[model samples]
Target: MKQPLIIIIRSINFSRVNKERNKRDIERNKRSKMVSSASSSEAKIISQCFVKPKTVSETSKDPYNLSPMDHVMLSFQYIQKGLLFLKPSDGAIKPQDFMETLLQKLKDSLATALVHFYLLSGRLSTSVTDDASSYSVFVDCNNSSGAGFIHAKSDLSVGDIVGSKYVPLVVQSFFDHHNEVKAKVTELVDGVFVGLSMNHSIGDGVSFWHFFNSLSEIFSSQETIDNNIKLFCLKNPPILRQVSTGSVYSLPFSESPKSNPQFQTQVLQERMLHFSSEAVRSLKSKANQESGTTTMISSLQSLTAFIWRSITRARKLQSDQETTCRFVADSRPRMVPPLPMNYFGVYISLVKTTAKVGNLLENEFGWAASKLHHVVVEHTGEKICSEMKRRFNPPCALPSETFYDPTIVHMGNSPRYDNYGCQFGMGKAVAVRSGNNDKYDGKVSAYPGREGGGSIDLEVCLLPEFMEALESDQEFMSPVSPSSG
Candidate 1:
C-alpha cells in the first residue's frame, strides 16, 4: 500500500534537560497504596430485572427508520463496553442499605432517562421492502423491550480491582445485549463496582456519555414537585433529521464458509497502562520541544505519537514497509450547523494517517504528533460533510485490516470524554475500564483517569511478542506503569 505524504516536519534535540524534567514528573505522581490485595471473593448474582419506562406515549410506539450513520454502524455488528468502580459512601450506611438504595435509584433514574431516549430501550430490526429483495434495518421503538439490570454481591473490597494489575473478569457478565442496558452492581466490603455494556450501533461515545450524565443528574436531584416536573424536560431534545440514504456508504457483506479458523489460531494479550497527569504533561512538553515550534500539542496527540513510534520500533518492521495509524473523530462539531449535544446517534468519522515505516521510526516524536494534528485539523465542517456525501465510494480497507497487520495501530475512545464523572449519588468513581473481553490486538482505548487531574489511562492490546518488546522499551515505559490482565 502507498503511504501518505508527511504534511510537516520540524526537528529538535533531546537533551539532559528533557530527561530531568520527565524524572521529576514521575516522582511527583507516586503515591502510597491504601487497599489490600485481590482476594478470592467472587461476585454472586442476587437478582435480575427488566427496567422498562414508566410511561410510553402512543407516539413512542412507532418504529423509526435508522439514520444514515446508524445504517453504516450496523455493518460492524459489535457491542461496546464500559465499567465504573465506586467506593462506599463516607457515612455509616450498612451494606444492605446501600445496595437497596443504589439499586432503587438506578432503576428509577434509568426509567426516567429512557422516556426521552427511548431508542435505547428498543431493538434493531430489518424489514423487507415491497420488492422482497431490498431490506432496511431500524430501531423498533414500540416500548416492548427494556434495559437489563443485574444485582450481585462480592466479598472483595474496592482496592482489589482499582489500581490492581488486572481487572476482574467478572465484569463481562454485567450486560446481556448491546442494545439493552446491562448494569451489574457488585457489593464490596467497603464499596460497589458498577459495570455497563451498550451496543455501539445505537450511539457513539458522545451519546453514551450524554445518557449517563442525564441518568446521574436524575439520580442526584432531590425528590420534589419542581424537580419531578423538570425531570421530563431535557436540555437538548433528540432531533432525528431526515438523512439521505443516497449519500450513505454501503459495504459488501460476505460470509466466510470457514468458521473461526483465523481467530482461533491467533494469540492476543490485553494490558492497561496508567499515565499520570504529570506524565502526560511531560510527554506534551517533550513533543512540543521536538517540534521546535511554539504550537501547543494536545495530550492525546502527543501520547498517541509516542505510542505509535514505540510500537513501530518494537515490531521491527522493514525500513521501507508502510504503516498506518487510525483513530475516530467526533463529527458533530465538524458538521455544517453542528449537531446538538444531545443528538444521539453515530456521529463520528474515521481518521487514517499513514507513513513509511522507516520515516516514522527515524523521525523525531514531533513529526508523528504533527501528522496526527494535521489529520484532525483537516477534517473541518465542510470537509466532513463533503466526505459524508461521497460515502458510497470505495471505503478505505486499511483500518479494518489493521488487526491482522503488525505494522498497523488503531486507537479507540478519547480522554476528552468525562467517564469518571458518572456519579450515581455516590462520589466519583475510583476507576473506570472497558470490559476484559472487548480487547483486540493492534487496538488502543484511552480514557480520562479518575484522579480528577489531566491524566490518561491507555487500555492497549497487542500480540504477545509485540507487547513484551513494548513493555521493555525504556522510552515508552518511562512514563507508563502497566496493569497486567
Candidate 2:
C-alpha cells in the first residue's frame, strides 16, 4: 500500500467567541517565544522598504513634460535582490553605486516612449499623487547582527526577510482610513531596504519587467548606458490617458459608503520555503496527472485544495458549509491586438472558486483536488474574462452590501529576474523572502530559479494552528524528490 500524504490546514474563521480566545493564545505564545528568543541571541528588527531618488539637474530638463505613463515606467526601476551577502573585499560596489548603475541600465536597455511618461507621472507626487503612481518596487532584505553589522529592528534576524508595506498608491485607500498605513520607511541597522511605488493604475508585472530590464542594463555598465530610454519626448509615443467617463476604470467602492477598516497596518509576517527545481517539477507532474490541467492550473488547484482542507481542519468546520479562494491573472495579453509587453498600465483580472465546506473534507484528497481544478477552469472562461474586461473598462459593480472577501490570494513571480544577478558583489543569498499583505486572510507568492533544476520560493501566512499543521505534515515538509536540495 502506498503511503498517504498529510496536509495541515488551520482555519481563520471561527465562531466569534472562540476567535478572540484563539488569537490571544497565539499572540501570547508568540510574545513569549519572542522574549525567549531575543534573550538567547543577538538579533535585529527592521522597517519596510523605501527608495531615495537621484537628484536630477533642473537645467537639463527635457523639452517634453513628463506624463503619467513616464512615471509608471520610472517606478519599474526598482528591483528585488533575492539573497545578497556582503563581500567586504569588493570596494567598488557600494549600495549607492549599485543603485545608480541600475538606473543607468534601465535607460540603456529599454527605450520605449512610455519610460518618459512613467517618470513624468511619478514626479507629480511623492505618494499617491496620481493613478500612474500605483506601481511599487518592493525591496526585501535580511536583518543581521554578525560582526560589523548592526541590529535592524526588534523582530528580525540575520536571515529574516521583510519588505515595503504595499504597492504605492494602490494601497492609498487603506491609508485614508488609518494614518499608520502612511508612516514613512525608516533606517535599519542590519538590512538594506527600499521600495519604489508607482501607479498600478499604469502598468502590470510584464511592463514592470520590461522597465526593469532597461534599468538592469544601465546598472551593469555606466558608459554603455544609453540616454535614449526616454521615449515620451519622441514622436508618436503610446498614450495611456485615463478614460474620463469610461465605466471600466471606475471603482465599485466609489459610490459606496466608506466602511470601518478591519486590518492592522505596516506589520509584516514573513515565511520561506525551498523546493528544488526537480522536486517542483515532479510535484507538478504528479499534480498534472492527478488533475489533468496545465502546470499553473494544477499547482493552483492542488494548493487551493490543500489549503482549504487544512483550514477546514483547523476551523473544525461542521460539514456542509462553504468557503472561497481568489486568484489574480494579468489580462494585458487578452486585450484587442494585445497591449504592449512594456505598456505601463494596470490591467488585471480575477478568478474565484468556491467550494462547500464538506466537499473539501471528503474521503479522498485527489478527488477534492480535481474538483478544485474543474472549478477554477470553469471560473476562468470567456464569459468571466469578458465580464471582467467590461467591468474594468466601462461600467459595472457588484451589488451593494456585498463584500469580496478572499481567504487566500496567490501570485507568480517573474522568473526572468534571476538572470540579472541581484547581488552587487555580495555572495548570493541562500534564500529570498517576500512579505505579506495583511489585507487578505492569507497570501502566497511563487518564485522560479534555475539552480536545483527550477523550484519555487513560497512566502505564506496563516493562523497559528494552520501554520503548525502545514509545517508538521510530512507531505509538505518532506523533500518531494531525493535530489531536491
Candidate 3:
C-alpha cells in the first residue's frame, strides 16, 4: 500500500494576556489534586470502551495496519492567522481552565464517545474502523512562532477521497462560527487551524460535526472547566447490537478510478461565508412539518437531488437508474455500559440511499426532497449483520471478483462544525477551508456558524462540468430549501 505525504510544522511559544500565568499555574496544581491523574483516567476511559481482540485475524483489520501514511487519508488542512477577539477586562483566561473544560467536553462529545470503542479492535469491513486501539489521536500546540496562528487538518480514507473533501470541514466551521459564538474573531496567516486524522471507516461528516461541537462547548465555557474530567462512561458503547445484517453491502476494491490524462494535481478552494443559526433552525422546522423528514435527511436529499438534476440537464443524459447517496452511521452503543468519550478509535457504519434521477428534477422541490428522504430512511436499516460479516471476511481466491463502483455518490453534513470556539489570547478565526481526493467529486456538506442564528454554512464540491451547471443556476447558489429555512 502507498503511504500519504505528510507535512507538520510545529512551534510552541505563548505569552499570557492576563495576570501572572504562574499564579494560574498554582491554582491549576491545586485543581490537579482535585482531579484524577492522567494515567489512571485515560486508562479507565480506555477500559470502559475497549476489550482486547479475541484473535489475530481481527488484528489485521486494524486501520493502523495500513501504516502511518494511511493516517493522512482524509485530511483537510488549513492555516489561520490574525488577532482574535480578546477583552482583557471580560475575565481572567487560564490554560488549565481551557484544558480541563475541553477534557469534560470530550467526555460527552459524540465524536469522542463513538471513537472510544469502535477503534479498539480492527478495521470494520464496512464503515470506518473496526479496531479502536490501532487509531491515533494527538494534537500539537504552537505558541513559539513569531506569527500567531493555528493549523487544522482532518483525514479521510480511500472511500471518502473520491467524493469532495473540502465540503465537510468548511461547512462545519461555517455553521459553528455563525450560529454558536457569533463572535467575529480573526482569519489571518498567523491564526490557528486544528487537525484530526481518522479513517472514514470510523465515521462520516455528521459524526465529525458532533465531535467538533462537543469540543467547542468546552472551549467557550469557563464555568464548567475542571482539570480532572472523565470523557466516556461504559453504558453500552459501539451500539453494535443495534446494527442489523440486511443493509450491509460488499464493496470490492478491484476496480478503482483511472487517473485522467488531462487532469494534473488537485488544488482546493478556500473561502468563508456568514449565516445566522436562527435561519437554519426555521428551515428545519418547516421541512419537518411539511415533509415529515428529519433535518439531516431532508436537507441532504434536496442538495443531492438538485446537483444530480443540474448535471443530467447539462449532459443531456437521462436514465431510470436511481441516483445514490451514501454516508456513515456512528456505532458506539453495542457495548454494555457504553465506552469512554475520548477513546480514540473507529466505530461507524455506512448508510446508502438511492432515488430515481427523473423524480429529483421535478418542479416541486419538496416533493423531490421527500422522495430522497424516503430512499435514505429505507436503505439505511439496522438489519444487515450477516451482510456486514460476509463483506469484511478475508478475501478468497476466485477467478471472477466484484469491483468497487466509482459512480456511487455520498453526501453528509455536520451542524455542529461551526461551533468550535477557537479562541487563543489573540482573537477568533477569520476563515476555514477543506479539500480531498477525486472520490469526493460531487460530495456536499453543511455545518453551523458560531454566530449564525438559524442559517447553516454550506459547501459543495463537484466535477467541473457539474460545478458549472450548479453555478449557472442562481437558485442553486442560494438554494436553501424552504424546509431548511
Candidate 4:
C-alpha cells in the first residue's frame, strides 16, 4: 500500500503547564489513587426507575428484529459513553433546586426521545428454531419497560476528574447496562457528568448518537412537550428494518448485554493523550514526504499508525515478535447498494494489519501506516458483507488472546462522533470519557479534541509498566503537549 504520513502523533510534554509537573504528577498520582480507592463508598444512587416513552407506537408491541450484524454484536458487551459538562453558569438557582430541575428535565426529555426510538425500550429475548438446531435473539418490546434512568451523586469534585493526567476510575459508576438501555446524571460540585450505556445489539455508533442528540435536543428546546409526544428531528427518524445477510447462526441463547468482560488480570492505567493539529500536520507531512505518496495518506490513517508504533515500542518486544493493529469501519456506505446513513444496526467491517515487531520498528513511519491504508482500502463491499456473515455464524467470540496479547493494539470509537455537541441545555461539553465495562490493556478510544480543528484525543488503557514506558518514550513524546486540549 502507498500513503502519506502525519495525522495524529503520540506523547506529551506537560512542561507548558508547570516546569515542576513531573514532581507534581507523582504527588497527584498518589492522591488520585487514594481518591479512586475510596470514592466508591462516596458514590450514592438516589433513585432508579425505568422511563417509558411518553407515547407508544402500535407496532412497538411487536418484537424488534435483529440483523446478522446485531447478532454478531451480541458476543460483545454494552457500548458506554459518558460526557462531562460544566454546570450552567447561572448561580442564582439554589443548589437543591438546580439538582431537582436538571434531573427532572433530563428524565422527561429522555422519555420524550424514547417515544420516537421505541425499540430501545425493549429487552433482549431468545427463541428456539423449528429445526431444533439453534436459537435466535431479538428485542422483546414491552410497553412497561423502557430505558433505565438513574439519579446519582458523588463527593468527588470536577477537579478530581479532568484536571488530572489520568481519568478517574470512579466515572464508571455513572453507567451500567444489560439488555436494556440506561442513562445516569451525577451531580458534582461545579460540574455535571452524564453517562449512557446501550446494548450494542440495539444499534451502532450512528444510532447511539442519534438517541443522545435526540435527548439533548428535547431537553434544551423550549417547546413544551405535551402527552401527545411532540415530534422532533423530522428529517432523519431511525430506520430499524433488519438487513438480511444470508448467514446462519448458532448464537448464544442468552438475551442481554454483558456488563462484565473476561480478560487477563493486570494493574491498568488509563490516560487521554492529545495530539494538537499542528503536531498532526507535521507528522502527516513528514510521513507522506518519506513515503512519496501524499494523495493516499489520510490524517486518521497516519494517526492510527503513529499510535500503533508508539505502543509497540513501549512493549519492548523481541525483534521477530508479531504485532496486530485492528480497527472498524462503517459498512453503511460500503454495501453494494449502500445502506442508508440513518439505517440503525451494527453494519461494520473490521480491518486488521499485522507486521513483525522488527519490521515496524525498523521501517520508516510511513511503511507501517501504508500497511493500515492498504488493508482498509482493500475492504470492499463484498468483503465486508462476507466478513459480517462469517464473523459469528458458528456462535463464537474472538479468542481472549486477541485482547490480552501484549503485542496487540486496538482502536475504537471515532473522532467524528459529535460527542461534544451532545448537550442537554448545559452548553457544549468540556471533556468526554467512556466507561470501563469493555476496557482492557491496549484498549483505545478516539475522540475529537476539545479544541476542534483537526486535533485528536486518544483515551488509552495499558498496564502500569506499559503506560509508564509510553509516557517516558522521548521518540514519541517529542512533538506535543496534551494539556492544550
Per-residue lDDT of 202 in model 1: 72
Sort the candidates on TM-score, descending order: 4, 1, 2, 3
Model 3 misses residue 254 by how many Å? 14
Q: Could you tell me the TM-score of candidate 1?
A: 0.81
Tens digit per residue, CA lDDT, model 3, 1-485? 11111111111112211235333423433332222221211101101121121122332233332211112222322211111222223346553354334333323342233233333223222232354222332111111111111122222211111122222222222111111111111121222233222233233443333333433443444345453544433333333212123323222333335962343322223222333445444444444555554455444445444544554454333556566556544444433454443433344445665556565454445554565666545543243344445644432222111112324455444444444354433345333334232224445455555444445555555555555555567655454332211
Tens-digit lDDT track for model 1 on 1-485? 10000000001111212345333322322221111221223345677766666678675576556555566654442344444445454768865686787788778777787787776666666666555544556567663447667776654445445544434333333333333445556655565666655556677888877776776676676364263463466555565444454633333434447764343323455557888889999888888888765477788988998888888888888999999888889988878787776677778888879999899988899988888888888889888767766872443222322344567787888888878666766677766655533355577888887674888888777766787788889989998854221
Every model's Cα RMSD, please? 10.9, 13.1, 15.5, 7.5
In candidate 3, position 138 carries an lDDT of 19
Overall lDDT per candidate, in order of appearance: 0.63, 0.36, 0.34, 0.70
Better of 2 and 3 by TM-score: 2
User: Which number leads on lDDT?
Assistant: 4
Candidate 1 vs candidate 4, lDDT winner: 4
TM-score of each: 0.81, 0.57, 0.47, 0.86
- Give the Cα error of residue 32 in candidate 2, in Å: 9.6
Q: Over all chains combined, what TM-score does candidate 4 have?
A: 0.86
Judge candidate 3 against the unseen true structure and give its global Cα lDDT, from 0 to 1: 0.34
